[model samples]
Target: MRFWLLCGAALAGTMVADTASADTLREALLQAYNVNPTLTGARARQRAIDEGVPIAKAEARPLVDSDVTFQQNYRGISPFQDNGRSISAGATASYPIYAGGRIKNSIRAADTRVSAGQADLLATEGAVFTETVAAYMDVIRDVSIVELNQNQVKVLETNLQASRDRFDVGDLTRTDVAQSEARLSDARSRLTVAESTLTTSRENYRRLVGLLPGMLEPPPPLPTLPQTPNEAVRIALDNNANLKASEENAKAAGYDVRTARASRLPSLSASTGVSYTDYLGTLDNVTGSAAGLNPKDAFTDSFFGLRARMPLYQGGGPAARIRQAQALQGQALEQVIEVERLVIADARSAFGRYMAALETIESSQQAVAANRLALEGTRAENSVGTRNVLDVLNAEQELLNSQVLLVTARREAYVAGFALLNAMGQAEMRDLGLDGGTLYDPIVNYKRVRNKAWDWSDDPAPTTQATRTATPEEDPRAQGPVTPPSN
Candidate 1:
């Protein structure tokens, strides 16, 4: 029966899938950075933003249009008198010679908005990476806790069996046996909870990493950190994506104000047009010219001229718009200040929490060692009849508690370190070395579309899904493991 029980346990263990080639955190991050659906959507949105520059540029270009007309008229009541018929065609072209700087300022505003969009994209990328890291760490933490709980259950089972044998031999009382059974039951209950937590963490991992987690490798050492919170805040102020975006937005709003003011100034434009009409033998002159379809008979006219207009007044609409834009620009500038303060506060808070977690790790390690020794001493004393079974059980529980604390402390230390990196705005691909070949450079797309008046290319725009050429030697997978930057 004992042999069969052992075989049953072995078979149960085999039910879990083998994961010999455990996935590394770096590999998970690379997968998320490269193909996460949220990131792909953001890239597509940025490509749409790149079109705004070209749309604004259209204002300074020419406009051309054409029209054709045909007409027939009947003369008063002479049956054989000639009928009047005419056909006409014409084309007109208009070019804006000057628009009092409105066109230029509009283009400037659009260019600034594109810059702001790129910064927003950067912020989104950072957020996705942060979530992926959190999910990866959660799985690792919960798995370790589950294993620890399982071991505790096994240890309690052994203690319970020993207490039962002792009670039968009169070495331990019924109360001692009852205590052991109670502790074993409690350990089993905790193990069930730990298993549930691990399952939840794995589900979150699947959501972020695009696959259910296999066995995950332990994370490597943390990245280098600043020596002080002040230094971290300084870095955040300079590099935070949200801060940069707000500054760009403020500049765009300033240009908007300029564009509104220019609306009140004089504007100039030039236009040219030509028209032709032919009455194939109208009633008025049909017989006089027997009009051999000659070139001189068709009525034609052409004219070209420049015109200027100044807006004297229009119920103060332009002035009201200018004021509105100026107010919005002020609001944008204040938002920059708000974002800077928020970044600094987060940096300092994460820095403090990380330092506390490091200290807890050291303290918990010492506690675990001390509690382990105390448990051993208590058990030996009970074997020699100097201590009771209850004392031994209490010491064992203390040691288990200390072990759990140590595990939690280590997890907190690693997670807090990453939080600090995120607060400082350094949690991006280039900083983390996750940017493989063919980095998505928004500037490339902006330049491609900004000066274009029309899209005549057979290929689509340079979107995230567009085909890109890469060098034969550039193997993206060979880029090597992503490591933290040196301080």
Candidate 2:
């Protein structure tokens, strides 16, 4: 009980020590949102997906091309030997008049897929934030446990010395002294384990947040939560990113089926071109007189035409493609349901854990108080010779255990609550009110690139957005000797 009370006071003091300068949950999340490699990579991938829309739309636009050809004497197979220096230049332009809906459906599918990619990017953001929250809470929990364990080791050390003095004065036995020493040793070992856990948790925090953690302010209060698991499921089914992405994918796949079916229908296009050819006075090199041969002869030609194509026999490929697309559309539709189920399960499970952890925290607090009183009573009774040293030691250990459990329960409750929010699509940047910096908007990039047709436009070279840090030295936990110290 003293440990818990001390920890509470310590945390309060820490919070007040430098509230303005202290690192916060929002700050940590913002760092990750800005530079976390996983989130950045997902954003880049979604941007690439956005280009699919323009690429598909390109099929419906006009295409213009130009070419020039030059011929030499060695290429002449006719008696017009010096037909050599002839040059031909031409330009052709074609515009789609109709495509049996293939181009339209393809563009629709690509556009819908861009929506799906946006949803996927949203999902990735949520997942990374959840993981960062978990890691933050883990470090806090482990730090508190390490502090408690260190305090216990100190208490046990004092008890061990007292036991030794009492034994020297004939008030205690060797067994009593040995028991105290053993407990102190065990407490020291546990403290070492707790420290190692803290180090590992810090490393994980750095992995997510792009820097080593500073003095982390306690997490802010969670948003209002759903009252029941079924309510949570309802919310998740409506808001879950994965489910939304899957739904869009199913729609895109349906469009793909239509695009494939369009292959059997006749397509029409308009084409026009102008050509210029110059004999380069090759006729002047003619060995014999030829009718209408001019010293310099050149001709210009122009034409306009329309073309229509229909698939008469494609070796059953178009039918197979249609069937394949239909099956995939079915698969995509099924995936939506599958993801919905997962979201529901995740929401309910997280809610259960949060509730359970809250109860454990309450119980552990009570247990801590009880064990604290028990330890005080046992120590007084031992002083009066009514209780043994072993009983007092056991009570102290119980108090420490209860305090550790209470801390852990609180951490778990916080993490689970955040996870529940994540599943419900309420743990994103906008949801968290993280005002640390500008939030990433996938739509801005999507809209900018989706309808672009400029051939000369270019994007800046991609540079890594993630931050780098020096790796920490090898942890003692990982570098210790294989064998235990001999007793």
Clash totals for all models, in order?
A: 0, 0
- Residue 334 lDDT in model 2? 92
Q: What's the CA error at residue 11 for candidate 1, in Å?
A: 30
lDDT of 2 by residue, 1-487 (tens): 0111122222321122244565777778888999999999999999899889999988989999999998655435664544346789999999999999999999999989999998898888899999999998888778778878988998998899899999999999999998998899899999999999999999999999988887676777676688899999898888888889999999999999999999999999999999998877664443334745665568899999999998799999999999999999999999988998899899999999999998998898789889989999999999999999999999998999898888888889889998998899877776676666678898999889877898977699999989776543545555656688889
- Whole-model Cα lDDT of every candidate shown, in order: 0.79, 0.85
Clashes of 1: 0
Q: Where does candidate 1 have its weakest 10-residue lDDT segment?
A: 1-10
> Whose lDDT is greatest here?
2
* TM-scores for all predictions: 0.82, 0.91
- Estimate, for each residue in 172-209, the C-alpha lDDT of model 1 and write its tens digit: 88999999999889989999998999999997777776
What local lDDT score does residue 410 receive in model 1, on the 0 to 100 scale? 67
For residue 341, model 2's alpha carbon misses the true position, in angstroms, by 0.8
Candidate 1 backbone collisions, by pair: none
